[model samples]
Target chain A: GAGVSQSPSNKVTEKGKDVELRCDPISGHTALYWYRQSLGQGLEFLIYFQGNSAPDKSGLPSDRFSAERTGGSVSTLTIQRTQQEDSAVYLCASSLARWDTEAFFGQGTRLTVV
Target chain B: AQRVTQPEKLLSVFKGAPVELKCNYSYSGSPELFWYVQYSRQRLQLLLRHISRESIKGFTADLNKGETSFHLKKPFAQEEDSAMYYCALSKAAGNKLTFGGGTRVLVKP
Candidate 1:
């Protein structure tokens, strides 16, 4: 697919359990970003990965949240000890370059924490 | 700090009517603004960027530095154009983006 791809379109997990969300960005894109959208709220920046560079994790809310981009293509966002507040739509986006360019987004993973 | 704001949570208009979705941003440096749209059951996609200064699907947004706004406009609203629209801003020196709460436009025939 030409667009950014995300797995587990929907997930239901209990509190204290851990969950991992995956993202497959568009081919040849060098920059990827992760954001979370809570109900009726705006997108909250989570992390950013540039090709072969140190990721910008400033947006990450807590230590339990971590992400990695392997081979500069696919990325995963892991949340440990999931709390009820963790429920939201996790969105992944990729751009051909960096901030100066436009980005393509995926359908997003809707995680529901109970 | 960079911030984007969309005052209207929802806007409704009749088909063929002119429509405008307001977007405002607060950034200290050069501003990079973008308008993204998400149709029903679809992923959010870029609609237009202020730098391009191009009209997409008859939609155009003018970057107002003085007003600190980038309002999207279309001569005639179409049913297919109804979607959730978000306004975002990224400061020139940063990779992080600030997004607004989003505005949903509904076009009725």
Candidate 2:
């Protein structure tokens, strides 16, 4: 793909239900980032993946929020027992290198937890 | 911990008027600052970085280490420039970026 791709574009789930958001980063990009944005709020860093391993997981809101990347390409953010506060736009971005580069972002997944 | 702060939630400017979007940060080490913008129905994209010192689409931001500010500025605002702007800070070589609350700019005709 020419740019980062994310799916499903929008999801509406009941509270306590689990949800999964997927992100496919740009080809050959080694750095992937996951961020959560509340309504009219700044992005909250969730995790950062350097290839298949995540060097930073300190930003995850809780233990129920976990993410994984496979083959250093596709990444999935999973939230177990979702809460109303979990409703937000989940954005994914990829960069060629860790530094001195711009990150390309996906359209983002709008998650609605009822 | 590094943090970015954007004070304005909304700003309106007439076309051709000067515009400034404020940003501040807190970091102990040297920080790299960036501005990202998102237009209506579009994905977030990079506007400019402090290190590059390059102006894009008539917008520029200067890093002020003394005040820990990196406000985005434009001499003449355009309707096309209406968008959501975010300020971000990163470590000298860090992969993760700390983003500030975005400011929604509306350039009226």
Candidate 3:
């Protein structure tokens, strides 16, 4: 694809419901990242995947938050039993490589936990 | 643990006025820094990176290792420069990028 793509630009789910956000990174990109953008919290790193290495999950806020990148090209962020505080924009970015390269961001998935 | 700090939450300046967005980071190892901008209704994009030592859209940022800061600056701001700016840091070996609490710049006409 020309740029990073995310599915369901806006998602509205009831509290306690599980929601899944998807990201399709640029072709041939080896690095992918997920971030959460909230009102005052700014961009919070959620997870990062580089090639075939073990993903760095240090940023996942809780057990309910999980992500998986399949085939190193597409990724999914799953929020289980979502809470009101989970309402925020989920962003995905991809870069040619992890070092000294630019990361191209997606339009972002706006999740609204009602 | 690595961290990035953006002191200002909001900065308002008149068009053609000089503008600077302060950024500071705390990292134990060598750091790579970058500036990203997001205009209204647009996706976030890279404005510049310290390694490149280049300017984009009339904006430049200098990495001061002594102060652990990478501040974005522009001599004359333009209305189009109004956007949300973020400062990010990553390890030299390319770890996950850590971002600061973005600063919103509103360039008045």
The lDDT values for all models are 0.91, 0.92, 0.93
Top lDDT hit: 3
Name model 3 segments beyond 4 Å from true.
Answer: none
Q: How high is the lDDT of residue B9 in model 2?
A: 92
lDDT tens digits, residue span A25-88, model 3 = 9999999999999976689999999999899999999999999999889999999999999999
User: Candidate 1: lDDT of A95?
Assistant: 84
Please provide, for model 3 over B11-87, each residue's C-alpha lDDT reduced to its tens digit, 9 standing for 90 to 100. 99999999999999999888889999999999999999999999899999999989999999999999999999999
Residues A1-114 of candidate 2 have per-residue lDDT tens digits of 989999999999999999999999999999889999888787889999886554589889999999988888899999999999999999999987656678889999999999
Candidate 3's displacement at residue A9, Å, is: 0.6
Best-fitting candidate, measured by TM-score?
Answer: 3
Report how closely model 1 matches the true complex, as a DockQ value: 0.66
**Clashing pairs in model 2, backbone N/Cα/C closer than 3 A:** none
Chain A TM-score by candidate, in order: 0.97, 0.96, 0.97
| Prediction RMSDs, each to the true structure | 1.7, 1.4, 1.1
* Model 2 residue A6 lDDT score: 100
Candidate 1 vs 2: which has more lDDT: 2
DockQ per candidate, 2 decimals: 0.66, 0.68, 0.74
Judged by DockQ cut-offs, is candidate 2 incorrect, acceptable, medium or high? medium
Roughly what TM-score does model 1 have, to 2 decimal places?
0.92
Model number 1 iRMSD: 1.7
TM-score of chain A of 3: 0.97
